[model samples]
Target: MPVITVKLAKGRTVEQKQQFVEVVTNEAVKKLNVKEEWVTVIFDEYERENWASSGELHSLKFGEGFGMKGIEK
Candidate 1:
């Protein structure tokens, strides 16, 4: 089985996650030669405060409620 773990800031709709998983699973099947059922996709969500870059927390840099919708730079 192929296990894929994706870590990101939290707050996304279920539909978005589903679509992402579907696409990732399909790609894994094609690229890794793995069966769809054998490909595992795991989403690891974190709070903005829990993620940081360049010595600043995402929550501090982007302010609160950041990444509460979609991907943010």
Candidate 2:
């Protein structure tokens, strides 16, 4: 079995998540030789204030709307 964990800033639609899961599951099944049922995909979403990079919080660097529509940098 293959377990995949994806972590990202919050604010995505269900359709986006479903599309990602489908693509990831297909790749896992093909590359890892795992059954579709045995492949697990997990998403861990966080707020901009809770995530940071380069010793700076994303909220401070990009405001509270980072990763939202029209604000992905």
Instruction: Name the candidate that leads on TM-score.
Output: 2
lDDT of prediction 2: 0.84
Alpha-carbon TM-score of each model against the true structure:
0.86, 0.87
Scored by CA lDDT, what does every candidate get? 0.83, 0.84
Model 1, span 1-73: residue lDDT tens: 8999989877777998999999999999998898998988899988888988999888777875645433364
In candidate 2, what residue range of length 10 has the lowest lDDT sum? 64-73
Q: Write the per-residue lDDT of candidate 2 for residues 1-73, one digit (tens) a residue.
A: 6888999988888999999999999988898788999988888998888988899888888877535533566
- Please report the candidate that would top lDDT against the real structure: 2
